[model samples]
Target chain A: MSGRHRLRALGALVVLNGLIPIRTQPFYVVYLLASPLSFLFFISVLSSGAFVPFGVTGGLILTMLSAGTGLQSDMTHYRQDLKFQDIVVASPVEAPTYVTGMALSELVYSTPGLGVFAVIFVVTGLANLQSIAVLVGVLLLVWAFASALAFTLATYLRDVRETFMFSPLISLGLSVLPPVYYPIDRLPHWAQTAALFSPTTYAAQLVQGSVGLYSLSFGHALLDWGALIAITAALFLVAAFKARWKEP
Target chain B: MASAVVAQDLFKVYPGSHSRTPALDGLSLTVPTGGVYGLIGRNGAGKTTFVRIAATQLALTSGSLSVLGHDVAREERKIRERIACVPQESRPLYFLTVEEVVYYYLKMRGLPSVEARRRTREGLEELSLGEYRRRLVSQLSGGLRRRAMCAMVLASDAEMLFLDEPTTGLDPIARREVWAAIRRASREQRTILLTTHYLDEAEALSQRLVLIERGRRILEGTPGELRGRVRYPYRVALQEGVAPEELEPYGRVATVEGGQTLVFAREREARELARWALERNLRVSMGPVSLEDIFLDVVGRSIDEDTPAEDAEPGHDEAKA
Candidate 1:
């Protein structure tokens, strides 16, 4: 493809992915509204076959899928034509600025999913007004976390084929092994402790508990937020180190 | 005047799956403060790799590189501030307009909004791209896209500019225009380091030329000095009616084509061969040799012989530039 056409497609795709949610499943919607613990609530809805209130699960799933696809596109298609990293290396723009700019762009593209979840939650009486606001705030954080991780991963993988092959496996492992879809309390003590190492678990826990979908102490929520910040910072640093702006 | 660029024992080795492919094998060269230097090499000759490292876009596997007295490794940010690059096969972001691309680069260099916009306007006008100021880069044709990329670097007010194959796909007229722009930039005292397969380009524009082959410096001198290195005596082109049998009596004849013959001798015997060719009424063309022919003789390969088909022909797009 010509360079211009590829870039136009990238811009369009960014806007499209940012604005639209992947699935309209009722449980997915409920999962978005239940902040940190929505993953836990999603498991309950999946097990009970009950009406699932829109909460964090839906947002997390949407974010994971979007981030995965976004990263794959960057690796496979964009890398061949555009050395976006050249801009960072050649200019004074540091890794944080580059990652933050990309994340904001992706956030703009992914905002519609959160908006849809918020509207559905309020209209269905599945979530209270206060919870919906907190859910929206948490969903923004989730978007930030997803975009950052995706950008970092895109830098590490050498090509699209490798990213495409590896991303889903990593995402699935992170999703299932962490406390994303269920409460840590439901698992064995060792498993619960192990989940703490996964950023997604902290993100999922924060999303579920903050939105009132699941009960958690304020101190636990604070701890999750602190861990999320630390993970984001570390990933940004790793991206700066591993980013190969020059042609291979 | 301080050197615009300096490097010592610059080396870059790409680690392959099993072994390492050395790109820049201890290459070292310097560009003076305000002149155009042409780096000529075949594809995969490490020309692009050298430019990338000097531009501070790539890290050196070993060796030291400095731009405007700033060490690339220790003072990357300072080095970056002084250099602008139009990387090989690169373009501005597809979604941004021509003006936006220029403005964004200027801003990255810490130009204020007003000055950035002013510089953007001037750069576009200089390259005759003012008409397409509002057009998105994605909307431009291939040649124009290249011009826009060039303008971005030019607009940045960088002291040292690195252009990797700047005129690869441009048509003759566009190539001249781009060359004129480079000359103008050089006149403004910006040091330019450019690479191209177009030997005539290197001959016409460069104050000094560095010819590399197999990751080694094969020749380096002023274009005229390199041209003078061709010891071959006389190049004789015959008319279609001339026969090779008739030309063989004068000197050893190498038939280049159906009608063209090249006669070689020592420099002292060059005039003698020309006289012999004329005595036979064989149409003879003689002149100071070009860098192209000299390069072919030294490297035993022609730059145009095996150029990849996908590389756009020079001057294919006009609307964008």
Candidate 2:
């Protein structure tokens, strides 16, 4: 397919999965925002508002990561239940374009939830232009990494019900188990080092550093960005080169 | 006529997880460009596998295949660009309205806004789905959903269209509509590769067809040529109350459902048998051998015997069970 057609397919998919659903059933946005907003609410209440900024920052990353991980169920449904994959594979649309389009559609679905987190960021006085730029960068990388990982995993599934088993497990592994909603220094030395293996840890630390909730030297912040970029790039390579497009 | 699709000794074996039988074992045929070319087969006879491979949805285990003069394996992008398919298992996206499903599919195929809308409107009208155009596919009946899928592909300008059992769930009227659409496309000089086990459908629509069994070609020709391949040029079907032994003296006799006895014979003998039944006041129908009889003669079984229940429901009049 030519680049223009690929883009057109991508745009159409986004409108189909993202715009159409939200328009017809806007109430689903509540379900999307529930997890992150609840985490923000409870953490703020439990910590007596001392960690409100941390909660707000983590909510942003969590919301974006959830959108990425959500691709598993979306893609599995499209492939298994809807049989859209066969139709798409036969068309002029390339696999990478299809995958990228699906991933972006999920992100678009979470736009309303992301908007709530943006309001929280401003309310917490953590919305400077520089910090916002860094936070946006961190959220995009996290979303990309999670989306690539989820898309690759979705191809291995034979049934849509299998997604129910895997999507939440992936979300917990990528988001909750890391230091996304808590300061990394709070963990013991070994636990903190182990968390380093997850991309979400770097994303959380970057958000925290930008929002002034956590202290980080320039070198440490640079390392965090480097690690997040590297991990995301590696996952995207797998999604692009190794993901299943044609059946055996 | 040039070949639109050519498969040379194609073999497609599913992984161990799937059925042990090879989906396509050295199955080969050439589908000529323009008009309808039917791939008729019993259930599990590898028709869908061949269409999937030719349409670039699945890969062949061995041998060479090409579509529109491009290799299926090496030139998938080029092949995909020129062909559209309504696969056997395909369904329209339930979330989109029927019109949206067709319109967005065209848009995704890179059609401009005005052209896509025009074709979408026309496709829905052609398939008699215009009334359901604004309804979500989830709300439509299975037959309507199937028609929506057809509308999506039929509206496109692709050179070759792969319609795998496109009218399997449709009623007789809807099936005729689809047949008409296929005919129109053929009149426009588009090659349509259709797969169905409905003998009447294949006979009415396909200019040429191939009958396959267990992933191998048993017959390939025009309907007349295939009917000519049968040794018995006529058939005499005697309704109940006829003893098989009584008809054995005339020709090959086989008992079918509802206690109907089918006797295949040469034209003169068949005429004598029909007259004999008439003298006895027995119910009998005699005619030239049909495609179904030819299929039974070569394969040693009725096609319905092998067709799974879900492939064609017994309740539908068009099922011809």
Using DockQ as the measure, the top candidate is 2
Candidate 2 wrong stretches, greater than 4 Å:
B307-321
Q: After superposition, how far is residue A186 of candidate 1 from its true place, in Å?
A: 6.1
What are the candidates' C-alpha RMSDs? 7.6, 4.0
After superposition, which runs of candidate 1 have C-alpha atoms over 4 Å from their true positions?
A1-51, A54-57, A60-79, A121-144, A161-163, A166-171, A174-195, A245-248, B17-21, B233-255, B264-267, B305-321
Q: Model 2: per-residue lDDT, tens digit, B170-202? A: 999999999999999999999999999999999
Residue B188 lDDT in model 1?
91
Compute the lDDT of residue B305 as modeled in candidate 1.
Answer: 61
True contacts kept of each: 0.24, 0.64
TM-score, cand. 2:
0.94
Kindly list the per-residue Cα lDDT of model 1 for residues A1-248, writing each as its tens digit. Answer: 23332343344334323332222222433332333244435644676733344233544445544543454455333444555456445755554554554454455534455566556556646576655555555555555656656765665565556676766576665666776665667789898888777777777676667555568788887787788778766765666665544433
- lDDT per residue, candidate 1, B1-321, as tens digits? 887778788766554311143566778887788979999988767687778778887667788888889988888877765777887877666767788778766765556668878999988888888999988777788888888888888877788888898887887877887888899999998899999989889888899989876556778889878866766534545554456575565555543666466654454455665776688776776665567667767777776664232321111011001
lDDT of 2 by residue, A129-202 (tens): 98989988888888788888888877768777888888778778777888889998889999898999999899
DockQ of candidate model 1: 0.20
lDDT of 1: 0.65
Worst 10 residues of 1 chain B by lDDT: B312-321
